[model samples]
Target: MSKPLFAILLGLSATGALAQTVPPPQIQVTATGIAKTSPDRVTVAYQVRGEGTTSDEATAKARDSAKAIRTGAEGLLRGDMELHASDFDIAPVRSRECNRDGYGQAQLSTGPCAILGYVVTMPVSIDTPRIADAGTLAGLIGRLGGLQVGVRGYWLSDDRPARQQAMRTALASAKAQAQLIAEGSGARLGRLLRVDDGTNRDMAIVVTGARARVTPPPPPPPAAPPIQIDLSPAPIRTNVNVTVVYAIDQ
Candidate 1:
């Protein structure tokens, strides 16, 4: 054979050997696991809003109401009960007025617009392990004028254990799925090649049992009725997703 023909034959042989050394195929699968449990803690929120002709007056009024609430809440605080001020804000209140034109075309003009007054708001939060006292606290705050109450039900204080449990279940699920796929394709799963931690989402929902809004009536009743606060038991859901890649036996 000529030299050129011999060289071409050798190149084809090398290419065939390289092709025979290709790696086996891989299978990947993803799975999610969810765990739910009742929350172990409760939190209640209160707001005090004051409106006055001046910013200082409005802020002073708001501060007074907040102090009263803090004092009252202190009395209700037990070993597990916690009370603290969360937020405060003050802003000017605005009003708008319009008048018709002489041509009777109803062309309105800015009549009398000014900063009528100032408004102030303060927010307080209470966290307690004693779930039953939520109602009593709400009633107490309701009786105090210029205060609004909102209740938030159960939330897990710590989520580490729950997350670990979810991760274990997620891995098992992924393995099972990968095994199933391998069996369907008439092959056995060899070993784990890769792992990816997918989305891990945790959410807690607070069920509000009661909301109290006190508005002074023209002739307010001799006394306000007792406010009933109920916090239903709500569960927190923890979810974990994982993607696993396994090698296929040749």
Candidate 2:
């Protein structure tokens, strides 16, 4: 080969060798951490429902039921306790004699499929910072004509502290995993280069066997004894995910 050709070949070989010897700039590890804690807040969900021959009548009945529930809940609310109405829906009620298709959609049959009435429903919730009052709230709301009254779940009013702790734990777990990987590959873990995190979110715990019994309404008599309910809920679990990048030292 000529001198110029030989020099070019030698330069290409050196470049390839250098590229092969260089290591990746960083190593990345993803980890998830979980923290379990007792709930600071208890939530009860109930619905006020009324059915009447006309829409206006149904709405009025629902309104009355809501007023009664509010009045009854007022005495139970302590500091940091709240009552909220989340949604309201009005739907037509049809006779039970209506025919149904395979999809469960109602079909007009030769028989009467006329609209029987209208039903109005409003979903309400009681959120209290005191966890012990969940059963009491459920009981009171049930007596106030609140249908489907039950403990919805247990939650944390403020999840910041739990999220922070979870993130720290996740970061530590990532570092440990990164170290293992680095050592296996004949490298050492270095400074943290970057972090991608899942933001703060609450994971509510579902309470089972905490439902309250429904009593026929007109509001219970004042002489009636208070209902006793026992509620045992599991701890809320918060999970945090993090992806961390660390510079690799060789």
Candidate 3:
């Protein structure tokens, strides 16, 4: 071969050898960690509904009832107890009547439709750390006329600590998994190239039980003890996912 051709061939062989000896890029591993904790707060929602012939009367009645409830709740407030009035709304109540023909068979006829009354509703929300008072509060609201009580599931007031702990665990898991993979492939795990927080955009999992609807029942027999309600909430879970990149040393 000529000198230039031989030089070119030699240069190509050297480049191929250099490429063959170079190590591959770092390995990336994704892992998830979860942490569970019990709820630390309880929230109860109440709605006061008033019905009257006129909208003004209905609104006044509802407002008065809501004010009374708020006053009572203020007295019940203790450490970490809070009361919030959410909404006040007024809407028309509708009623329909059926028209019958002389044969008594139902005929397609337009019946006299009119507004029966006006209904006003006031919504109130209460948050407290006292889980044991759920039963008493529910019963009290039931006894109060023109009030409907809705009990929401328990929740964690603060989840930052849990999330941080889960993130740590997820990172550790990713490192361990990467190490195992490296060892299996006859390589050693090197420095971390990158760590991506995959949980920042994901929402935490909050486990809640089915809501219970309770209306005041007839008075129990004198011999029967008063009823108690227990609303045990499920544990709240925080999950963290991480994508970790680590150098592989051969």
Candidate 4:
């Protein structure tokens, strides 16, 4: 037999009575802080590529290019500027030919595909605290030929200090606002109830416009002066926001 409607309502009322409660009054404030710091280092990456009918030939060409690049940047290799070269990678260039079968389906040749040539590639990186030298180095790499240059980033090596400063600023703002709200409502601000940290740590400064053609060209004449490209990197900015909840004593 089903229960009576009054009995069901009484049971529900009992359950609700057991779970009833009241929360204390509180004030919540969200504040943001921004801090800027000069970039202390810059990293640049460049690729050296060579193509030849044989693997050995391709490797030799790529090595030659790498040597040329090192020699060109020799002057900048000292005093906080360092170069890092990764291992070379060699891959085959392939070609395929196919014909139509009797069923009108495409059928590839039974034998192995022919290799047109081999390509060798080497990746090199430059790390320097002298941010102003980035542009000059890029120009030199472009003129040296057989390379494509890229800028990794302009960064602050250690951003903990900046993050701490921003957090302090945010906390101060949040506390001040909370106190103001409590006083205006005829209540005293009590202890801190909760704090939510919402700082974004994945900040990166990106730079572009440092690429060279794949085809290598002859070096310029002795009379021609080197090209200069100035890239003044802007300061790195860090922003942090925090949500704070404070108890109220009425």
Please state the error at residue 78 of candidate 4 in Å: 2.0
Looking at candidate 2, the ten consecutive residues that score lowest on lDDT are 214-223
lDDT of 4 by residue, 161-243 (tens): 78777878889999999999999999999999888875445545345698863533343332334576678788899788899
Ranking under lDDT, best-scoring first? 2, 4, 3, 1
Q: After superposition, how far is residue 20 of candidate 4 from its true place, in Å?
A: 13
Q: For each candidate, give its TM-score against the true structure.
A: 0.67, 0.69, 0.71, 0.68
**Per-residue lDDT of 180 in model 3:** 94
**Relative to the true structure, how large is the alpha-carbon lDDT of every model?**
0.72, 0.80, 0.73, 0.77
lDDT of 3 at 74: 42
Expressed as tens digits, the lDDT of each residue in 1-250 for candidate 1 is 6998989999999998998998669998998877887777778788888889999999888888876665565555433567677677987665534222243334322334356789998877788776766776777676674366867566778776777777788889999999999999999998999777754454344555877644322322224444556656657898878888999996
Where in model 3 is the C-alpha error above 4 Å?
Answer: 1-23, 98-114, 146-148, 199-228
By lDDT, who's the top model here? 2
Clashes of 2: 0
Q: Model 2 residue 18 lDDT? A: 100
Clashing pairs in 1: none
